[model samples]
Target: MAAMIGGAKPADAGAIAALNRAAFGGEDEVGIVERLRGDGLVAVELVAEQGGAIIGHILLSWLPTIMDGRAMKALALAQMAVQPGHQKQGIGGGLIAAALDQARAVGAEAVIVLGHPDYYPRFGFSAALAGNLASPFSGEAFMALELVPGALAGRQGSVSYPAAFGL
Candidate 1:
């Protein structure tokens, strides 16, 4: 909560990469972030900064989806990360809250995420909402949240993440 939450600028990519690397203990997520940026798939990017240093990041990318062969675009929340030292300090939650506000402001319909079942629902993501969607990951870990009520109503099909996701 001590950190200032703001939109991530292009110049913060290096610091964001380092933060993701430390948070996830690998470079895969960092690579994903870079690729998303390079491919112009990112819809929203947010950061948590303190002491003039970037300590956390959250990115929402455009996800192309089909429901019964019908196409509509949605947002995907990916690689929400906080520096190891900043874990458990509410930075991740703050970033998510800010990202959701931005996403909603931009008239996004819904957002999907593959994350901890318990951790994400607190932010309105629900496994039941993602039930009919097919993905490479487990259903329990895949979830969705509607920015506007009934956004996902009666929809069922697969999500095609931007090519940058390497899916």
Candidate 2:
């Protein structure tokens, strides 16, 4: 059977961290996940499991965005990774789909990500949509997706991500 994507449990932290390290070839992602969890900033986290082992992971965290003088509730797709051996099998895409769905279900108005210019647009993320929002990371790699239509229609604003991001 294929791997199944589901909400991560507290017990899954160790496995998720390990997978992040393995998939990213470093500890940056692991540390980010830990800090996010420690700071109580994680809004949604999911894992892909098969044969009782986690092979993929994705996380969304609370992001504070102010647009047109009003605060809007948003989420950030902080990190996503799939085990090296599973990279091309669509597991990562599944994790993204599930994460976005969970983000919407939790009432996030929009979600932001700094990722591949070519890869993220397929998921409806658009740099043009994020053009009005200012962040440390900009240009094509930084994109936004609105879970609620017209949620991000604003003249200009800035996003303040949690301290866990170290930005």
Candidate 3:
């Protein structure tokens, strides 16, 4: 409740990386984010700020998807992290909402994510929606949301994540 979600600035990179390290207890996420930027795959990057400090971060990147033999415009909710001290305070949800809004604003038709099934569904992410899409990740953890109505309907094919994900 104390944090406001907004787009991340270049100057906030170090803080974002540090927050990712603390949230995930490792450097893998941080590396993925950096590589996303370097590869020009970044679609949206949002941060949660409270008292002028970055408390959370979320990144969405271009996801290469082929559906029904045609390419579709999609974004991937690549990584999201809330500072350990800031978890469970609704910051993560806020980031997801805001990031999705931004993704839509940027003309993305759909968004996919590999995340907790229980959590992402509240925002309309569904493994069933991603069911026909092939990816390195599958099962309930791999989900998708159609920002534009019926975007994923009757579509079938594979999704390729940016090389940064190493998946």
**For each candidate, C-alpha RMSD in Å?**
1.4, 0.9, 1.0
Please state the error at residue 66 of candidate 2 in Å. Answer: 1.2
Candidate 1, superposed: residue stretches over 4 Å from native: none
How many pairs collide in each candidate, listed in order?
0, 0, 0
Descending-TM-score candidate ranking: 2, 3, 1
Listed in order, each prediction's TM-score against the native is 0.94, 0.97, 0.97
Candidate 2 residue-wise lDDT, 22-119, digit = tens: 88888888888999999999999999999999999999999999878889989999899999898889998999999998998999999999999999
Candidate 3 weakest lDDT stretch, 10 residues: 153-162
Candidate 1 on 64-154: residue-level lDDT in tens? 8766676756799997998887788898999999999999887788899999998999999999988878777657789999887877776
Ten-residue region with minimum lDDT total, candidate 1 = 65-74
Q: What is the C-alpha lDDT of each candidate?
A: 0.87, 0.91, 0.91
Count: clashes, candidate 2? 0
- Per-residue lDDT for 1-167 in model 3, tens only? 48988888999999999999999999899999999999989989999999989999999999998888878899999899999977898999999999998999999999999999999999999999999998898999999999989888865778988789976
**Candidate 3 residue runs with Cα over 4 Å from true position:** none
Candidate 1 lands at a TM-score of 0.94
lDDT of 3: 0.91
